[model samples]
Target: MSLTVRILIGLALGLASGIALAEWGAAWEADAVAIAQPVGKAWLGGLQMPLIPLIFALLVTGITQAAATARGNRIAGRAIALFAMLLLAAASAAALAGPLL
Candidate 1:
């Protein structure tokens, strides 16, 4: 199956399991949380591990290319403008989703 389908399946199973454990296994709640905490943290940490270096590399590459290209200054300005607009759009999406979520 596709990655998206797998993710959806995993999400559904996770929710079902969580709900079952939370509602029917109250006594195990604390232990369950404790046991799961490290896994959650590791998942988050793993996701963050490569982001900084990847972002830095992208920034450096963009800078070098912008400097080397014809009409370099204008291109850099346009790139920054586009990047800002993208960031704004992403922020808007998160903002819009936050309240609904």
Candidate 2:
């Protein structure tokens, strides 16, 4: 199946199993945590280890291209302006709603 569907299925199964274990598997909880903790940490570390350098590379590449385009292209500049405004608006909305959440 597609990656998206596989991810959704995994998410649903995880949620269901978590709830089942929480409700009826108290005896297995300690063993489950012991098994899951190291695995989860390793998974998270695998995901995170390359993120900083990847993000820095992407940002450098994106800014270089954007600056070059925005310098001579009015349309690109205007589009970038609109993008920035929307980004700021989204951030502001998130900040305002964060406390309520």
Candidate 3:
């Protein structure tokens, strides 16, 4: 009923369908990849279309708001740390998963 539940259901279904396709679509894998890959990329590009501007807007807003208070420095530090940690975690996951894949 909620957005989170819907997203979770979508993720689960996507995974299930992807697994089913991978297992049973071997004969058509090339065609499937040829078609699906571009569609997937287009979907991803659509999703990312607003990301850069949104991030830039948020970053500017944060900087402007933080400039007025001393606590903003601490908040900014924590945000940067969190961002770094997320980047590190992503890199670590890619590093670990690359060999397996």
CA lDDT of each candidate? 0.77, 0.75, 0.75
Over 1-101, each residue of candidate 2 has an lDDT whose tens digit, in order, gives 99999999999999998998888889869998999899998898799667655654565567658878667456555655665676567667876996698
User: Cα miss at 73, model 1 (Å)?
Assistant: 10
Which 10 consecutive positions of candidate 2 have the poorest summed lDDT?
52-61
Candidate 1, run of 10 with poorest lDDT: 48-57
TM-score, candidate 3, is 0.47
lDDT winner among the candidates? Answer: 1
For candidate 1, lDDT tens digit of each residue in 1-101?
A: 99999999999999998888877888768987899899998898799667655765586578667677765877776776676677567667876996698
| Runs in model 1 lying further than 4 Å from the true structure | 1-7, 71-101
Show where candidate 2 strays beyond 4 Å: 1-10, 66-101
| Per-residue lDDT of model 3, residues 41-80, tens digit only | 8898799667655765576567657755756777676665
The Cα error of candidate 1 at residue 36, in Å, is 1.2
Predicted structure 2: clash tally: 0
Q: Give each prediction's root-mean-square deviation over alpha carbons.
A: 7.6, 7.9, 8.0
